[model samples]
Every structure is written in structure tokens, then in C-alpha cells.
Target: MIRIVIVDDHPVVRDGLRGMFDGDDRFTVLGEAGDGREALAVTEAVTPDVILMDLRMPVLDGVSTIRELRSRGSSARVLVLTTYDTDSDVLPAIKAGATGYLLKDTPREDLFRAVLAAHRGESVLSPAVAGRLMGQLRSPAKEPLSHREIEVLTLIARGCTNRETAGRLFISEATVKTHLLHAYAKLGVRDRASAVATAIEQGLIRRD
Candidate 1:
């Protein structure tokens, strides 16, 4: 079973998640924490297989907690479950070593899938969160993505919001996030600025 630990300031959120994962043959909710410092303490004590982290919390907050986890070389992958999927939220979590990111509103099934994927060593993002990440796969020489990811990239280059991109591309924001996460892995880039700069250098988008 996938051993999981949850870290969120809200007790209800933690309880709900625990109930969600309880007794699943594929996963086990080992423990949980209500703040950053506690998260560290519990994580060190139990060495959970994965952490379901909330970005906004009192005390250490999710970003700093993730940094500490990395600094200590904890192999536990973090899956950031937050209410905000904005650029501000998405960028820092990845920068701080979170393996996956999604809004708290994520459907329970997708949340479970994301956790499982992260445990398997895959980076996952909500589509609204992935557009900026996908922008970096701009390469002239490399084989371009099929029609969909390209649409996501173009909208990213144009600074369109994920909602706008979704509207334009006839897809959901989550779909956009998945595309960008795929692109991020392929391009070896993280976050918007690096992704965009790399794309420009690769001639995937016009410098003008």
C-alpha cells in the first residue's frame, strides 16, 4: 500500500482525506499534521511514502516545509493540495521541491491518481497550473507536441489565463495542466520564466 501522510491546518480537510484513503488496498493513511513544524516532526518520525501538503498554513507554510524536506534529503514526494493554483502558488511549490500540485477543489479520484503518480516518481500539475510550465518546451529542432500541447503553449506564450486557454482550446483547465506537466518533463524546465526563455532560445516561439 502507498503509505501517505497529510499536512493541512484544517482538521476537517485532514479528516476528510484520511477517510478518503482509509482501507484502500492501494494506499494507507499513515498519519497527519496541522502545521509545517509538525509536518516535519511527523514526517521524520514515520517516513511516509508521500505527503499531501496544503500550501497555506500557519507556522511554516507549505513552501518552507517542502524546502526543509528537500534540504534534509527526504525521499518522500510532496503532493501540494491547495486552494490556490495561481502562478504565485504553482511556481514556488515546484521550486521548493513539490513533486505535484493541484487545487483543493480537485476531484477525489484525480487527487488519488495524482498521489499515486507522484509516488511512482511522476510530476503532476493541474492544467491551470501547467500552462506556464508547458511554455518552456519551445524547441525548433525537437519534435513538436501534437495539436493540443501546442495550443496550450501558444496561449501560455500569449499570457492567457488557464481559463482563457481552456476556453480557446476546447478543453478543461486540468487537461491543460497535464499537458504542461508532460512538456515540463520533456523540456527539462520548471516554472514560467525558465520555460518561456528556453522556448525563445529554442526558436519554438517568435522572439518578436
Candidate 2:
């Protein structure tokens, strides 16, 4: 049986996932966590083969958790199971070393298959997420913003000034300006406000 851990903020979601895994003969749920920080502790103790990680949570978010897991040299494969499939959500999770991305609405059998694939170290993505990735891959001319560019834009969208963004991101103001300029060019916008607007419109960043 494949060992697993479920991490999500909602108790209902956690219970549902735990029940699903419990009913499966091929899988065994080792633990569950209410949020990313708790997940880190639980996962360290149990050392599951696969982790079902939700993207948004209190204490720590999924992307940051994934990065921390990688940094700590955890061997568990992370399968992101969340409601979000936007570019901002998907790209960051994948970049932070998620093994798969599956929407919460995925059919039961498909989610099972995805978990198996993830345990085998295979890449799994829901159809919507896959399509988004393929579109980015095929759109060479349109050029998706780099991760740092997206980060700058996200902070800007949150109403942070250039100096504030730099301080928060631990980069120089000049570097922040440089990232914004590159983002403006890629987004076909000439200013911070327009770049933020375009990025939000394109789903490259969320307004909230």
C-alpha cells in the first residue's frame, strides 16, 4: 500500500480525502494536517510516500510548503489538490516542485489514478491545468512572464509601491524597476498600474 498524508485547511476536505484513501486498498493515509505548518510536522513524523497538498492555507501556503519540503530534502512526492488552476497558482506550485496538479473537482477514479501516478513519480495534471501549460509552451511569441516578473506584478497588484515591493522581496529598488519594465514589455503595458491590470486580466496574478 502507498503511504499518504492529506493537508488542507478545511476539516471537511481533510476528512473527505482521508475517507477516500481509507476505502482504497492500494493506499493508506498516514496522517492529516489542517495547514502547511502542521503538515511539515506531521509529514516529518510519518514520512509519507505521497502528500496531497492544498494551495491555500493559514500559517503557510502550499507553494511555500513545497519549497520548504524540497529545501529540507524530504523525499515525499507532493500532489497539489486545490480549487485553483490559474496560471499564478499552477505555475508557482509546479515551480516549487509539486509532482502533480489536480483540481478538487476531478472525478474520483481520475484522482485515484493521479495519486498512483504521483506515487510512481509521474507527472499528473488535470486537463485544465495541462491545457494551460501547453498553451504557455506553445506561445513563444506571447511570452509568459518569468516567475520573478509575476512576483513583482503580484506585489504591485496588492498596492505595494516599488520601494515597498523591493523591501518585501529583498531586492534593490532598481531591480524591482527592472522586473516591472520587463513585465510591462511582455504584457504590452507601459506602467505599473496597467501591468497589474493586464496581469490580473490574464490570470497571471490574482487580485486577492
Candidate 3:
């Protein structure tokens, strides 16, 4: 049996996933967590073969959790099951070490197959997510923004000035400007406004 852990902030979602997996003879629901922090604890205790992770949560988010899991040398395969399919969500999760990315709207049978594939260490991606990744990969001119670049752009999108962003990120103002310049070049934008717009358009940042 493939031991599994369900991690999501919603109780209904968690319960539903548990119910679905519990009836399957090939899988077992080892435990559940409401947030990424709890997920770390539960995963460590249970040592599950696979983890179904949700992106947004009250405490630590899914991408950060995945990175932490990898840094800690946990071999459990992470399969992201979230409502978000945007580049901001999908790319970071995959980069952080998710074995698969699937939208919450995915069919039950498909999700089951995805989990099985993930347990075998195969990469799994929903059709829509796969398409998005392909588009990104095909666009040679559109390079991915670095983590710091995204942070700077996110702050700028929120109307923060370079100095303010630097203070918030605890970096020097010059460093903030450097990140902005890098982001602008990667996004093929000439200025902050255009860069922010392009990043949002490309789903690199959430639009508020």
C-alpha cells in the first residue's frame, strides 16, 4: 500500500481526500494537516510515501514547505493539489521539489493515477498545467524571474517604493534596485510599471 498524508487548510477538503483514499486497497491515509507547519510534523512522524499538498494556508505555504522538506532530506514524493494553476503557483512548487502538480478540479480517477505515478517518482502534471509549462519553456525570450526579483516585483505591485521594499526585505536599497533591474530585463519591460504588468500578465505574480 502507498502510505499518504493529506495537507490542506480546509477540513472538508481534507476529509474528502481521506475518504477517497481510505476506500482504496492500494493506498492508506496515514494522517492529515491543516497547514504547512503541521504537515512537516505529520510527515516526519508518519513518514508517508506521498504527500498531497495545498498551496495557500494560514501558516507556512506549500512551496516553502516543499523546499523545507527537500532541505531536510525527506524522500517523500510531494504532489501539489491546489486550486491555483498559475505560473506563480505551479513553477515555484515544481522548482521547490513537487513530484506533480494537479488542480483541485482534476477528476478523482486521474488524481488517483497521478498519486500512483508520483509514488513511482514520475513527474505528473495536469493538462492545463502542462500546457502552461510548455508555453513557458518555449518562450526563450521570457526567462523566469529569480526569487528575489519576484519579491521585489511583488512589493512594487503593492505600491511599495524601492526604499520601502528594501526595508521590508531587510536588504539594502541598492540591492532592491538591482533586483528590479533584473526583473525588468527578464520580463522585457523598460520600467517598473510595465514590468509589474507583464509579470502579472504572465502569472508570475498575483493581481490584487
TM-score of each: 0.64, 0.75, 0.76
Q: If the candidates were sorted by their lDDT against the true structure, best first, what order would they fall in?
A: 3, 2, 1
lDDT digits (tens) for residues 1-208 of candidate 1: 8999999999999999999999467999889999999999999999999999998899899999999999998999999999876555677789999999988888989988999999999999988778756754453444556557666777788888878888998989899888887766655788755666666555465544
- Kindly list the per-residue Cα lDDT of model 2 for residues 7-115, writing each as its tens digit: 9999999999989989999999999999899999999999999999999999999999999999999999999999988777899999999999999999999999999
Residue 88's lDDT within candidate 2 is: 78
- Candidate 2 backbone collisions, by pair: none
lDDT of 3 by residue, 44-157 (tens): 999999999999998899999999999999999999999988778898999999999999999999999999999999999999999989987897866679988998999999
TM-score of 3: 0.76
- Give the whole-model CA lDDT for all candidates, comma-separated: 0.84, 0.93, 0.94
Root mean square deviation (Cα) for candidate 1: 13.2
- Candidate 2's error at 118, in angstroms? 0.6
Q: After superposition, how far is residue 68 of candidate 2 from its true place, in Å?
A: 0.6
Candidate that beats the other on lDDT, 1 or 3, i.e. the better one:
3
Model 1 worst lDDT run, 10 consecutive residues: 135-144
